[model samples]
Target: MYGQGMSLRFGVLGLLAEEPLHGYEVKTRFEEMLGGTWKVNIGSVYQVLQRLERDGLVEATGDRGDRGRQAYRATVAGISGLTEWLEDPDSQPQLLREDFYVRLLLLGRQPNGHLARLLDRQRRVYLQRMRDLADQEKIARERGRPQVALLFKGGQLHTEAELKFLDAVVDEMGKE
Candidate 1:
């Protein structure tokens, strides 16, 4: 995966591409979208939004409510920037979280049944994630963000590959 900062920036742009929203709304939507797997700090979201606005990638629309909350929308340049990033083929190679690999390594010593169960659980999770990605891609397509759809399609491919790999592992365990 990309660095947290880059991922967070992409996420903010993605949200704004859907609709203009206040800072809090952005954070809330992000959490909701990630299913709480990601926890973004308010300060970090605000800082990125400020930088984006400064770079003219995004613009502050106007204040909302009596408390004067500022709302942000993605500028045309922002959408173009996101599309460029998505199309760039030079993305850093994904770095698997070492902790999960370590756990898998340790678990490899266990009986085949245990490994089979683990792989089964992983396959299910990957399939569900792929379904979610497909749904998101459809939404992006409907919104005229073909770039976002492409990104989501990549994610779907990754999930499908994982599911295939897990299935192989489960089969190997059965043979053992």
Candidate 2:
């Protein structure tokens, strides 16, 4: 399915709300928005679109696209739903099944030195991620995508926070 469930539904709805597009095109546009950070399968895109259409959030535009592909657009209700979702806060940081958390949990069962090495490696990776995000943010701003730039900035902050958490773990674990 989608990388982030529920969120992808709203993203698809928001894209359709902006303009009508075929399912494939919607997938392409959504990837473009995230600058290819997230990828949803074609089948998943159609599934989300189908669910949204069934939920009355979107409708067929009755317009055929290139090669007769069906196009979809957000309905009035879809626009309202999208707006509501935009204004609503996200529920996250539950830490359930998060990759890093799972890794840390499983790796903790291993021999002592494994976790220490992992923490050091992970810290370096996060630092590099921060640098990469700063570069990405600059390019996004230069491309007149302030929103995209903000997304990169958000990623940078998240990475930094994760690094801080790792540091705390290392401090308590004492390189053991």
Candidate 3:
């Protein structure tokens, strides 16, 4: 998963690479940076911070913030990892199994009307998500956040591709 949306660690590293941030700041900045596409819990952020600290990718700044929260900054190795990850082009699927593909296979056993309804519902959801992405993209552009806008654009493109695949599935199902 070395694509734009890699694991949360890289996101955390990228955030820290920009500047030091406390656990709470990391969580909030992550959500803000990605235009709210990924909502990470505060606990998860702290856990990642601890892991990053243990891995020597980050270190405590020895500065206490509000409520005694310790701030952390990315180390040189962390920045180097971030650079390497960005330069890597390996976007191969880590897992051979995809949940949606499995669900589609199961749905193949169902009647046409049932499968049609499910597909329709999914299409509607994708459409709504595209709309949301558009809105987020606009907000990001207005806020002068080009990276966030680009992220939203990627989401829009991916969702459009999914919709096309769904339509192709419906067409193939009709052939049977």
Candidate 4:
């Protein structure tokens, strides 16, 4: 369901479900909500919004100001669509382009002590990401974006788990 469409569409719907917002508000909120992980251009957001409106999933309200700021609200169809998309089965597994994982796989061919250093560095980086995710989660919760909060929480948990696993690997290597 999510695969057949751009993730930005669902994200925009989710945002609109909260409250009516202008295009500029949507763009700023989207970037803020994703913690800058998803860089959505203004053109793309407007395009998706236009498509959503054309599909009758969203409706635009009157201009709000002298700048011609038109606000968009999620229609009943949009809410249903977003709910269905969230409930859909794994249309596609998330693909992570993890350079560290690739390096770890190739570490056996490297010189002495290199793997240990790399793993140590990975642990540090993962810990930092965990911290960042935690911070994002907190911000999302404070801002009343529970869905965004949940996303960041999941990321934090995954990073914490990876950090723990990396620490174990480093310890085992040290004993070898």
The candidate scoring highest on TM-score is: 2
Off by over 4 Å in 1: 1-5, 9-40, 47-92, 98-100, 171-176
Candidate with maximal lDDT: 2
Q: What shift in Å separates residue 53 of candidate 1 from its native position after superposition? A: 12
Q: How many backbone overlaps does candidate 2 show?
A: 0
lDDT of 4 by residue, 48-152 (tens): 999999999999877585688889999999999989987888756553446777787689467777888888787788888988988988888898989889989
lDDT of each structure?
0.80, 0.87, 0.87, 0.84
The alpha-carbon deviation from the true structure for residue 98 of candidate 4, after best TM-score superposition, in angstroms, is 2.6
TM-score of each: 0.54, 0.88, 0.86, 0.67
Mark the 10 consecutive residues where model 3 has the least summed lDDT: 90-99
Instruction: Count steric clashes of candidate 3.
Output: 0
Candidate closer to the true structure by lDDT (higher is better), 1 or 2 = 2
Candidates ranked by lDDT, best first? Answer: 2, 3, 4, 1
By TM-score, is 3 or 4 better?
Answer: 3
Candidate 3's displacement at residue 131, Å, is: 1.8
Instruction: Report model 4's TM-score to 2 decimal places.
Output: 0.67
Clash list (residue pairs), candidate 3: none
Question: What is candidate 3's CA lDDT for residue 19?
Answer: 93
Q: In candidate 4, how many Å is residue 152 off? A: 4.7
- Candidate 2, which segments miss by more than 4 Å at Cα? 1-4, 94-96
